[model samples]
Target: MANETKKSQKILIVGGGTAGWMAANLFAVHWPDMEICLLESSDIGIIGVGEGSTPHLKFFFDEVGIEESEWMPRCNATYKNGISFVDWSAIPGFNHYFHPFPAQTDDIFTVPAFFSSINARMQGHNANAHPDHYFLETYITAKHCGPIPTENFPFGVAYGYHFDSGLLGQYLAEKAISRGVKRVIGTVTEVILNPRGELASVRLDDDSFLAADFFVDCSGFKSLLLQGALKTRYTSFKENLFNNAAVVMPTPMYGIIPPETKSTALSHGWAWKIPLTTRYGNGYVYSADYITPEQAEMELRQHLGLLESDVTARHLQMKVGRVEKHWEKNCVAVGLAQGFIEPLEATALALSFNTLSAFIKCYEKGGYSNQFEDAFNNEINARFDGVRDYIVCHYKVNQRRDTPYWKDNAANTHVSETLAQIIHFWHRGGDFAKNLYMNNLVGSYQPKSWACLLAGYGVFPPLRSDEHNAPAPSLPDMVQLGDFIRRCGLNFSAHNQLLDHIHRRPA
Candidate 1:
């Protein structure tokens, strides 16, 4: 088999969501001489529920030479410092916690204190290890401040964004098309494979064929190229991760839009509240095995105080897992066509961006051949599994024992060995960070993130009554810590102020 050079290569993207346009834009920039074209159907409808992003999205825009000022305002986007999780646990003071993206300041002060607190608590001493108290980002979120640190702030604060997914896809499509990437709006009715069993081209509904050197599958769950055409194997995480359905609803915005997505635990699942400039994206994610779609819709509506409102609910079924091979033959899967570990961490776009970035590097390194596809698949599979482990940790260590869904999650024995070992190491007071680093288990989420999830849920042993008079653990002073956080908070502006400034600029 002969490989084509970049100048002679043409890449065809099957589907047009955020993933497709992102692929087109990335290829246009990275392989400037490679011809890239994206095909999408007007018949396919994308979910309009507002979507949240990870910090990676900001980097994605940067990689594509787009500024936040240009994209955010057009997408009805709002700044997001982190996520505020409420009512996931029933422990007295642990009912609420904010999970912030790690900051550079964490290394100097907050993170060490956090690890010490967790270690002390593991030693049977009462040390406050709540994650919300130990993060500068949490303080910023609580104060409703944007994450852009002032010029002299000296420390970097990571942030994401909340946006309407549909609008974002459209915006990216326009940007890609303007940059010489061809956009063909047509449905792919058939896939044609070359004699080598790789994707040769796709047959559209109009009885025409589109050929390319490589194919990218962004065709959503139908997976027209990778799985459907290539026959790639799909693995399911249903045993450990039970949530497979979501019901989304929109509500009008109110005063003081905070710079954080809010996730609240409900009976059979959790509800997410994503704040955007135009409206609040609300949704309930649950397992249909334990609750019906109607029940989930009612629960979401009631939870959001919209039981009587005429707003209709949109339902979705999610496939929770990843493919055994992300890159197969000459085709690579992106977005839903690849895999989904659920959107609990708002990682959909981020994962897609990462996968595409890695694929671009590996594919280019191999001279457009499949030389490094094995390594790419290995790395991506590990990433998908790692994310799944983290999301599963939220359920496995949840403090609620009230509902069967949660209880079953808590007692489920289907977890991966790595996750079990990590949890066990946490309980045994081993250095959690070292465990992750030693095993090379740290993927996208950091060790502090794992600590946050555990400590935020108030997972701890019973405090001993000094055991006939032992020394108390020297803990960081809460008052002093609070003051330090407040002092640091002065370097940021109010969420509304920043958003207004960003929005006021015309895109």
Candidate 2:
């Protein structure tokens, strides 16, 4: 046992969906010399209809070393600045608010002025009436589907991508291959395990057994490698999330492109309208105990202003949350195999990216030691739990009580400790930090925490700020911001053109 030679590291990835390929590609990119193989069954089909991404997508692209020009057109992705939640406040015609990506703040100058103006706006006076006008998202999307210049915002704007999931998987696979990731095609019919309760190898249906030092479970809902072989326990989040089913559809983009993703609340749960360059990816995420698939589909159509037959729907059901430990034994679960949280705020893809990122850290830091794996598992679980809290907060913060769904949630829901703390601070007019690492920080900043629930849910406090805090901003500075935004000469259409120009440039 003295001076033992190390076992050569090999990573066996099960499945080829977005999660699988993403893990495979990242493994290949990070460890080009390591043996990396991805197994996907040709007979298996992907449920690509339920595809959308959060802004962390840029991180994925950067990590995998894919250029935007190379993947953007290939993925048929659309730039999404942020989600525009409509009618969640229960107010008619005026319930729109944005959760913009974290902007590098000149807090010294901007924060004081912003607070003063928001207070004025709350008081019935339209002081600079268009608060969002100063922000880039609203204006940029309006100008021909462009993104804000990456140079102008050094820290990167909060943005998400709307893409065809299947295509994205394929694109990622190509990237993995280019980086020397081996591909194995077949259905996994059996799993071989060592007495150590770790996966030793996976047997394909064709009778070939492939062995590896480590495994990644990207096998979608079946969790063929992680849960099936390891018997990992999936924690149920139904009480908090409630929504367990989805009816998804991909319809052609009818007209002008919408720059933002739209989530509208219904009696049962909520429906999402994600506009890609080519089509609108629509889905109704709801609780089956509350509404039938038929009812959910009907509701989605009504929300989209369509008739029943106007849209074809596919039904999907899933429990919220993932195994208590995403990494156990020698295998790790990525994508749906890890867990799902009903796609609210588009955290699934981001979570998948994070899962790979965590594994990379483990692989690089300590060559997959128990210490690293335990830390990775703990961090991943914390992120999902934090997101769960945020999503639940949306339901809890709603002013809607007309429907049984809304009423039940309002009366019986419990908010998470982290969210409760953030809310408490928000009530006192404090800005949420970008670096709150509940488990590990989900995003560098808490972008979701910045959104004004006060404005979105019609919770106008008696006073915007009590006396004796910071001196009320002088009127001149407030006017300057509004004037600066108006005269900033930021043209979104030009930004769109820049992306197109980048795409067209000879690579």
Local error of candidate 1 at residue 113 (angstroms): 0.8
Q: Every model's Cα RMSD, please?
A: 1.3, 3.9
Q: Write the per-residue lDDT of candidate 2 for residues 74-95, one digit (tens) a residue.
A: 8777777767776776655347
Q: Candidate 1, which segments miss by more than 4 Å at Cα? A: none
Candidate 1 lDDT for residue 245: 93
| Model 1 per-residue lDDT tens digits across residues 1-507 | 366688988899988988888899998989888889999998886545439988999999999999888999889999998988888999999999889987898888888788888888878887888898888999988888999978989889899999988999999999988888999988989999989899999998899999998899999888889989999999999998999999998999978888999999999889999999999999999999999999999889889889899998889999888889989988999999998887889888888998999999998888888889999999888888888999999999999999899999999999999899889888988577887888877777888999998889888888887744867666787788888888889999999999898899776
Error of 1 at 5 (Å): 0.9
Backbone clashes in model 2: 3
TM-score of 1: 0.98
The C-alpha lDDT values of all candidates are 0.88, 0.71
Off by over 4 Å in 2: 1-7, 92-94, 105-112, 115-134, 142-145, 150-156, 308-310, 428-450, 463-478, 489-491, 494-507
